[model samples]
Target: MNTIHTHFRLSYKIYDEAFALSQAAQCHLYLSLSQKAIRFAVVDTARNKFVVLEDYELITVFTPLQVAEQLRLIAQENALLQVQNWKLVRVAVSNQQFTLVPETLYDPVHQFDYLRLHADLNPLQHEVYTYRHSGLEAINIFAVESGVRLALQGVFENQPLQLVHQTSALIRSILHVVPRNNLRSMYAFVERSYLTLLVVGPAGLEFCNVFHYTSPEDFIYYILFVMEEQKMNPEQETITLWGDITHDSSLFNILQKYVRQIKLGKKPEDVEYSYKFHDMFDHRYFELYSLHLCE
Candidate 1:
């Protein structure tokens, strides 16, 4: 169905003016898709700020075709076509499967073989995308269903858009905020149906993986298991969390019992947000805001 869990407009005046001057102004559009919702933002690159941000949550499970129809409807509702000549159009997808490999051994020609070791591959039906982690000397290989990729392409037909796995955005965003000096720390980005856990140590990125869970118990199990696997002490190591979770969320409540140093993640300090966004939690829409930093 067409159910929207929540939607917000941060600066209508700026958005209207930006669209009206689309030909002269430099703008960037960012879209993020998760299993349960689609979120987008429009940024005025010249002003170095966000003009509009919105999200639509789905109540019914959507197939690729249905998701495409919904994406088109959302674009129409937001008058996305009114804005032209985007400085950049970046889309991040979180519903697909991904794996990490060292950059030294990465081979673009054999990408499918590398992914097949960790996930099933339908060579004819899935499209593989790779993102290089320059700092960590690793490359992230991910797959998105060709149908979904085509649907996304149709949403911005004829427009130049950079498609990337959501994990890349997550990694970029976390690195932007996480202190380099913190010898041991973990970051978790909780979405509707999945959570991504990233572990960092003095050496560098220690571990990173995504887990799907249906309940708070399942969520904490994965967190605790990761801590155990990494030899991290919950009593001392901090776990900074972002995305759809809150202090009062069941996931948070359960996590507190096992991890003493849990903290809420903050938005990237490098970007400026409008005062109109004051009502919303700072940690929310982190990946959306971080899209501006995506090269």
Candidate 2:
């Protein structure tokens, strides 16, 4: 059989957040190619009360008929309720760069990876999971650790970017580092003692970010203080910070710092799982909400 060897992906048209609706008006949208379509959209302003104008674009190497058939399956699963200001925008993407496999391929890989990774951790002290994944344009920097895993493009709007430069810089600044390479001081004790996750953004916007602090305590206390001052509890029930303060401001560095804190406070006692999901606050998650669109 002749094959196209084409890449596949599903682009979605997500509309504006609609006004709060009644329970009857609540709706969800999803897509499927094989047997069951997965639930991808759910407008739960209250309890599944709001709806939005969204559609799914299926990309594939299959014939047009195959694609249309898949679309029918999807529509049958999710009937078109109504219409709104939704436009179908065709974006030319370089599938060559990425495998661009059907999300069906990635979701399972991601799921298994998540469960397997979850099984191996310190459990006590380390109990959090969040990382800023790289955009489709660039690869993320978190594939090296035995205990760590990538959260990837899902952390934010499924856009190519999980963390924008401005958002990244905001995280860096919020951590209180000046972003200087030479200035970053890494104590040997800390390096030998902790795991590291370095987060890099385009310089100066590019890599000009460089700075160092006296101790990991400076960064740790700052984060704790920020949480406390803001009157918000750090989401994770327990935190373990096992790394040194005087290190790079990359995601790895910041995480190591936080891990050290977790160890000091939460002992991770009686937790079934040993793996920890350490995630950091990427300012972009909030910053992008403000802009509400790609510029």
Candidate 3:
């Protein structure tokens, strides 16, 4: 399905036989992002142009006609290619429900919540960077789009906190700079963005919540409440959370539990070439990386 992942970039796998891709698509273990499994898709490496948001598909809540309509609308803004094939699969997250996100309004922070994550690193070149979250006073929203960034401002424990994205990269092949000292150089390649809330008072920055909740119901309710408290409509909010599949996080299950149409973050690309379906989503990461149902 077309996933609007919160904590991931583009990932791909190669396919050998077309049938292999088909088989992979049918595997019951497709819902990799659950408390039960970590859904992962491999890219068709042979066609190596992965851009994280090139193309996407919906498996659980969409019908063939719906997919067609979605593609048609997307075509309204830009030319699009057709999926190679299509499949009927069900990803049932136990104790989970789903909801429909509004089609037009966009709350950038909620939309890119995942971008506000633990440090994202690029190892090939050994890059690393971290994003800190704090509520920005509505007055300072403009600072967010400015180019002067090294660290970012956020609300921590109800106070101001700052995170740096580094101004530049400095790598030295000779002299004293080694791989370990390539902080500036490595971070140069890391993609950077952050989510901040606007809560400014005469006093400085302050917004931290170290202790929230632990149970499934409490979690979902909390998240929903947070959204509502921020005056964000649950109907308009699209909550797509992605995390390491290994942890067995009940977070996804809880989220799916509350909403009417929760979107999972799995892709047909993860399947082996033989398992992948022909009419599945476009394998280009760039096209599907940010496919949001946000209206």
As for model 1, its CA RMSD to the true structure in angstroms is: 3.6
- Residue 177 of model 2 has an lDDT of 30
Q: For residues 34-153, could you state the per-residue lDDT of candidate 2 as single tens digits?
A: 111111322332342223333344444233234434433443334332221122111111000111122323453353244334234233322222233232222111111211112121
lDDT (Cα, tens digit) per residue for candidate 3, span 1-295: 9643222222434333432434422322111112211122223334332211122323332222233233334333322112222122111111111111222332444432322232232234221222222222211111122111111111012222232211100001011122233121100101101111111123322221211344656556655665556564555444432222112456555555565444323332322333343344332221122111000
For candidate 1, the lDDT comes to: 0.77
Quick one: how many clashes does candidate 2 have? 37
lDDT head-to-head 1 vs 3, winner: 1
Off by over 4 Å in 1: 1-25, 62-65, 81-84
Cα lDDT, all candidates: 0.77, 0.27, 0.26
- Candidate achieving the largest lDDT: 1
Q: Model 2 misses residue 30 by how many Å?
A: 12
What is the Cα-based lDDT of residue 291 in candidate 3? 15
Model 1 CA lDDT for position 6: 29
Ranking by lDDT: 1, 2, 3
For residues 24-111, what per-residue lDDT tens digits would candidate 1 score against the true structure? 2477888887657778878777767776777777556445445555566666656664454666788888854788899999989999
- TM-scores across all candidates? 0.89, 0.21, 0.24
Task: Return the lDDT, model 3, position 257.
Answer: 55
Q: Point out where model 3 deviates above 4 Å.
A: 1-45, 49-214, 235-261, 265-274, 277-295
Q: What is candidate 3's CA lDDT for residue 179?
A: 23
